[model samples]
Target: MRFGILVNEGPFNHQASDSAYKFTEAVLRKGHEVYRVFFYYDGVNNANKLSEPPSDDRHIVKRWSELAKAHNLDLVVCVAAALRRGMKDELLAEGFRISGLGQLIEAGIQSDRLVMFGD
Candidate 1:
């Protein structure tokens, strides 16, 4: 199956981001394709390159980047949401790109399932 993932929460502020990541990992491991992972609202924070959690905490942003690299996944941050949070192209982590909501729409149209995490 092909999936599109939408995340609407921040990495540390809620469990939504973590859940989305795990779900994506599991789906890929099951031989499914992820069309795209769209980060909207506070979820755009997942693309922030400057985020630094405590050493003991899992680095969610880095994990996303690594996952994208490993799978050649498209990790997209909503341009409007990112701009509202002061996230620019230079501030984005590896494997993440800033794009408009059209990408999300495209994902929904192309993927067999559109899985959303968070409100």
Candidate 2:
């Protein structure tokens, strides 16, 4: 199956990001394809390249970055939401890009299922 994930909250503030990450991993492990992982609202924080979590704690941003790299994932941060949150183009991680809402709409239209994690 083809999946599209939509995240709506910032990393660390809620379980939404973590859940999305785990679900994405599980889906890939099951041999399903993830068409796109779109970050919206505060979720764009997940793509922040400057995030530095505690040494002993999980690095949410890095985790997502590595996951995207390993899977060749399409990780897109909503341009409007990311700009509002002060996430600049230069600060985006390797596998992430800032894009318009149309990208999200197109992903949803192309995927076999759209899963949303938020709050």
Q: Which residue pairs does candidate 1 place in steric collision?
A: none
Looking at candidate 2, what is the lDDT of residue 100? 99
Most accurate candidate by TM-score = 1
Give a tens-digit lDDT track for model 1, residues 6-66: 9999998899999999999999999999999999999999998999999999999999999
RMSD of each: 0.5, 0.7
Stretches off by above 4 angstroms in model 1 are: none
Candidate 1: worst 10 consecutive residues by lDDT? 44-53
Q: Rate the local accuracy (lDDT) of all candidates.
A: 0.97, 0.94
How close to the true structure is residue 34 of candidate 2, measured as C-alpha lDDT? 98
Per-residue C-alpha lDDT of model 2 across residues 1-119, encoded as one tens digit per residue: 99999999999989999999999999999999999999999999999889999899999999998999999999999999988889989999888999999999999999999999995
True-structure RMSD for candidate 2: 0.7
TM-score of each: 0.98, 0.97
lDDT of candidate 1 vs native?
0.97
